[model samples]
Target: MLVAAAVCPSPPLLVPEVAAGAAPELDRARAACFDAVAVLAAARPDRLLLVGTAPEAESGDYPAGSAGSFRGFGVALDVRLGGGEPGPRELPPSLTVGAWLLERTHWQAAPPTARALPDTLPPGDCLAAGRELAAGDERLALLVLGDGSACRSAKAPGAWDERAEPFDAAVAGALGTADGPALAALDPVLARQLHVAGRAGWQLLAGAAEGADLAGRLLYDEAPYGVGYLAATWS
Candidate 1:
C-alpha cells in the first residue's frame, strides 16, 4: 500500500541546466519539491514508484535502474533511477525529472520503479493501474509528476483561457487536502480542454491512496511561466 507520496511538475525547466539563464525563476519550486521528496524519504517505504505523464512512444513500465538523460534537452547531464546497472529503457522527460530529484537528494530509501502513462489514458484505466500497483505487500511511496493547466495566463503555453483558473484551483485544492475522490472525479473532457497533463497521474495517485488515511500539505502552487507547477506531500 502507499505509505507516502510526492507530487511535482515535470517540466524540463526544473533542471537548472535545462533552464539555463531562467533557472532562478523556479528556485522556489525547486526548493519545495525537495521538501516534498524529503517526506518520501522520511516515510522509509520498502518500494518506491515514480509515475508520470509521457507521450505514447515513451509510455510504459520502467524497471529499477532505468536511465534518463537531459541530452534531449540540450544538456549533457544523465541520471539513472535507483542505483543498480542501467535498465533497458530510457526514461521519458517526466520520469527523468523524477530520477533527477532522487539524485539531487542522494536518495537511499528504496530502488525506484517508474511508469509512464500516456496522455490519452482513460481515467478508469489510470485508477485501475494505480490500484494494481498498490496491491503488493511492500510499503510503497510514489513520486508523481505532471503539469496542471498550461493556460494560466496570456503568456502561458496554451495562452489564457477563461476556464483555466478554476480548473487549476480545483486541482490545487485536491492536492492540498489529499482528496482522492476529488482527484478521481476530475472530468477528463474538461481536463483535456484545459490542457492538464496531471489528470492521469493524479488519478493514479487517487487509486493508490484509496483507503489510506494520508494527511496532505501543499508546499507549492505557482505558475511561474504560465504553466501550473505544484508540489505537495502526503503521509
Candidate 2:
C-alpha cells in the first residue's frame, strides 16, 4: 500500500550545478522538496518507488543504483537511483532529478525503484500502473517528479497561452489538497498543449493513493522561469 508520497517538479535546474548563478532563485523550492522527503522518511516505508516524466522511448523501469548524469547540461554531476551496485540503465532527465532529490535527502529507509513514463501516456494506463505497483505487502513510498504548464509567460518554453494560468492553478490546488480524483480528471489534451509534463505522473500518484487516508500539505507552488514547479507531501 502507499504509505507516503512526495510530489516534485522535474526541471534539471533543481540541481545547483545546472542552474549555476540562478540557483538561488530556486532555494525555496529546493527547501520544500527536502521537507517533503523528510515526510517520506518519517513514514518509515519498506520501499520507495520513484515515477517521473520521460520520452516515450525512454519510459520504463530503472533498477536501484541506475546512473544518470547532467553532462548533457554541461554539468559534471552524476547521480544514482539509490545505494546499490551500479547498473547500466541511464535515467531520463526527470528520473535524474528524482535521483538527485533522493541523494540530497540521503534516503535510508529503502532503496528506491524507479519508473519513467511519457507525458503522452493515457490516464487509464497510468492509473493501472500505479495500482499494480501498490498491490503488494511492502510499505511503499513514492517520489513523483514532473513539471506543470510551461507557458505562463511570453518567454515560457511553450510561450504564453491564456489557458495556462488556470490550468496550472487547478493543478496546484489539486496537489495542495491531495485530491486524487481531481488529478485523475485532468484533461490530457489540454495538459499536453500547455506543456504540462507532470499530468501523467500526478495521475499515477492518484491511482497509487486511491484509498489511502493520508493528509496532504502543499509545500511549494510557483512558476519560476515561466515553468510551474510544485512540492507537496502526503502522509
Candidate 3:
C-alpha cells in the first residue's frame, strides 16, 4: 500500500476577486475539516472511519447552547471492478469518494481544541467502526485529525516526530493555490504556525531530506486550510 498527503494552505476566505476580508475562525474550521478528509484518503483502505468525542458540558470553556459534538462517526464505500466489456451490473469505483469522505468526517461542534477529546476516541473504537463499515475486512486503516499540534509538539502523548516537514508550501504548490493575502493578514505568529504545519505535512508524506519514503507515488491536491492534501493506495 502507498500513501500520499497534501495540504491546501488556507483557501481563500472570500473569493480572491472579492474585497471583503476572510473570516479567520471560519477558515480555520474549514481547513481543519478538509485536512481530516485528506488523511483518511491517504490511508487508502477499503473503508473510511472516524473516531472522536464531543466536549462535555462540564468541560471548561464549553460553548453555550452548543449541541453535543460528534463522539464518533464512520462510513464505508463499496468498490467494484470489471474486465474489458463493462457489465451493466458492475458499478464504478470513483462514483464519489471525495463526497463520501466529506459526508462521513464532518463535525457539528467546534474542532477538538484540547487533547482530552481525541484521546477518548480510542483505537479500539476506530477499528470497530472500520470493521463494521468494511464488514470485518481490516487489512489496513487510515486515521485523520485536525489541530496543528496533533502532528507536531511533544506535549501530546503518542506524538511522534515521524513527519515534521512543512506541509503548507508543498500543498500550495501542488494544488496551484495561494495564500499570500491571507498570510499578510494573519498575525506573524499564526502565519508562521500555519506555514510550519504545512511544511510538516509535506515532510510527513514526502519524507525528510535523508529519510525513507513514508508514501509512494502519492497524489496531492489543494484543499481548504494551509494544510497538505494526499491520496494514497493501500492493501
Candidate 4:
C-alpha cells in the first residue's frame, strides 16, 4: 500500500559539484527536497520506491545498489541507490538525483527499490506500472524525480514558450494537492511540446495514489535557470 511520497526535480545541478558556479541558484529547491525526503523517513514505510525517467523504451527495475556518475555533466561524482553492493545497471540522471537525496537523508529504515520508466511512455502503461507497485502489501513510499517544463524564459533550454507557464502551473497544482485525476489528465502531446519531462512520472504517481487519502503540501515551486522545478510531499 502507498504510504508517503516526495516529488522532486532531477536536474544534475542538484549536486553542488555538478552545478559548480551555479550551485547556489538551486539552494531552495535542494532544501525543499530534503524536507520532503524527511517526511518520507518520518512515515517509516516498509520500503522506498525510487521512480524516475529512464533512457530505455520500456520501464525497467533497478537493484537498490545501482550506481551512476555525473561525469557527463563535467562532474565525477558517483552515487549508489542504497547501502547494497553495486548492481549491473547505471541509473539515469533522474534516479541518480534520487540516490543523492537518499544519501543526504541517510535513508536506512526501508529497503529502497528503483524503477525507471521511459519518458515518452504511454499514460495507460505508466498508470499500470504504478498500480502494480501500489498493489503490494508492504507499505511503499515513492521518491519521484522529474522536471516540469524547460521553456519558461527566452533563455530557457527549449526557449520561451507561451504555453509553458500554464502547463507548469497545472503540474505544481496537481502535485501540491495530490490530485491524482488531474495529474492523469495532463496532456502528453502538449507536455512533450513544452519539453516537460515530469508528465509520465507524475501520471504514474496518480496511478499509485488512486484510492489513497493522501494529504499534500507544496514545498517549493520555482523556475531556476528557466526550468520549472517543484518539490512536494504527500502523506
Candidate 5:
C-alpha cells in the first residue's frame, strides 16, 4: 500500500552545480523537498518507488543503484539512485533529479526503485500502473518528479500561454489535497499545449494513492524560471 509520497519538480537546475549562481533561487524548493523526504523516512516504508516522466511510452524500471549524470547540462556531477552498487543504465533528466533528491536526503529507510512513464501516456494507463505498484505487500512510498507548465510567463521556456495559470492552479489544488479524481481528470490535450510535463506522473500518483487515507500538505508552489515547480507531501 502507499504509505507516503513526495512530489517534486524535475529540473537539472535543482543541482547546485548545474544552477551555479542561480542556485540560490531554488533554495526554498530544495528545502521543501528535503522536508518531504524526511516525512517519507519517518513513515518507515519498506520500499521507495521513484516515479518520474521520461521520453518512453511506458514505465521503465531502474535498478536501485542506477547512475545519472548532469554532464549534458554542462556539469560532470554524477548521482547514484541509492547506496547500492551502480547499475548498467543511466537515468534520464527526470530520474536524475529524483536520484539527486534521494542522495541529498541520504535515503536510509526503504530501498528506492526507479520508474518513469512517457509524457504522453494516457491517464488510465498511468492509474493502472500505479495500482499495480501499490499492490505489492510491502509498504511503499513514492518520490514523484516532474515540472508543471513551462509557459507561466512570457519569459517561460515554452513562452506565455493564457491557459497556464488556471491549469497550474488546478494541479496545485489536486496535489495539495491528494485529490485522486482531480489528478486523474487532467486534460491531456490541454496539458500538452500548456507544456505540463508532470501530468502523467501526477496521474500515476493519483492511482497509487487511491483509497489511501493519507493527508496532504503543500510544501511549495512557484513558477520560478518560468516553470511551475511544486513540492508537496502526503502521509
Candidate 6:
C-alpha cells in the first residue's frame, strides 16, 4: 500500500525570546514540537510530501510578502511501495492522513531562500501542481503539512476567519470524498476528533499525549498547528 506523512510544528506565535518577561515554557513548547514530528514519522507512510512556512530565522530575513506567510509550519514525506502502484480502488492507511493532506495541499508565504526549495509552492496552486506531479504516477501517496488556513479558506463562502468554521468544513468535505481515509491530530478542546471513512476517505486522529483541553485551547486560542502522517499499506 502507498503511504505518506506530514509534520506541522507549532511554535508559540511569538518567539519565546521575544515575549518579554512572559515566562513562556520554551522547553515544553519545544518538546511538543518534536513530539508532533515523531508522531508523523511513526505512521510510516509510503510517499511523503512536506509543506509549511519558513523557519523562525528565515521568517525574520524576508519582508512579509517575500516570505510565504500564509503557509503555516510543517513537513511531508512520500513513499512508494514495491516499485509499483496500488490498485485505484485500494484504501490507504489511517492515522495522520487528513492532517497530511491539509498541510501539503495548502500553500504558505515564505522567504526567498526557502522559496527556492522544491516544496515551496503556494497552497492555492498546489492541488493542480500535485495533480500534475502525480500524473502517470498512480502508486504515489501524498503527505502534507498545513496550518489550517488554506483548508478553511477553501470551504468558507463569505468573509470568515480562515481559522474558524470553514476549516472544519473542509476537513468534513475531504472526509466525504474518495481521496483516502483522514485522521486529524486535533486537540479535543479545539474541536472534536473527526473521522472521515470512505474508500480513499480520511479520518481525524487526535494526539492522545497532548490532552484534549490543552490541544483544544491551542487550536482555538492559537493558530492551528500540528504534524500529520500517512501509514503504509500491507499488500
Report the lDDT tens digits of candidate 6 across residue range 1-235: 2222222322223233333354263444333434443444444433333323332232211111221221222322331211233322211222122222223333221111111112232332333343443345333333323333222333322223434444454443432232222333223223222211111111211111111111111211122222111122211
Q: Which stretches of candidate 5 lie over 4 Å from their true place?
A: 57-59
lDDT at position 42, candidate 2: 94
Candidate 6 structure, TM-score to reference: 0.31
- Candidate 2: tens digits of C-alpha lDDT, residues 128-200: 9888878877899999998989999999999999899999889888888889999999999999999998999
Error of 6 at 184 (Å): 16
| Tens digits of per-residue lDDT for model 1, 36-130 | 99999999999999999888988998998899999988999999998777878799989999999999999998888899999888989989998
Give each model's clash number.
0, 0, 27, 0, 0, 45
Question: Residue 86 of candidate 3: its Cα lDDT?
Answer: 28
Error of 5 at 116 (Å): 1.1
TM-score of 3: 0.25
Looking at model 1, residue 19 earns an lDDT score of 99
lDDT of 3 by residue, 43-139 (tens): 5544332222223322121111222211111222232111122223311111112222343445232221111122233333333332343333332
> Residues 33-130, candidate 4, lDDT per residue (tens digit)?
99999999999999899889877753588887889889888877888988778877788889889999999888877878788888889999888888
Report the alpha-carbon TM-score of model 1 versus the true structure: 0.97
By lDDT rank, best first, the candidates go 1, 2, 5, 4, 3, 6
Candidate 6 Cα lDDT to native:
0.27
List the candidates' TM-scores in order.
Answer: 0.97, 0.98, 0.25, 0.97, 0.97, 0.31
Worst 10 residues of 3 by lDDT: 90-99
Whole-model lDDT values for every prediction: 0.92, 0.91, 0.29, 0.89, 0.90, 0.27
**Mind giving the per-residue lDDT tens digits that candidate 5 earns over 1-235?**
9999999988989898999999999999999989988999999999998988888743488988899999999998999888778877789889999889888888888878899888989999999999988986779999999889999889998999989988998999989998889999999999999889899989999999998898889999999978899999999
Whole-structure CA lDDT of model 5 = 0.90
Which residues of candidate 3, in runs, are more than 4 Å off? 1-44, 56-137, 149-235
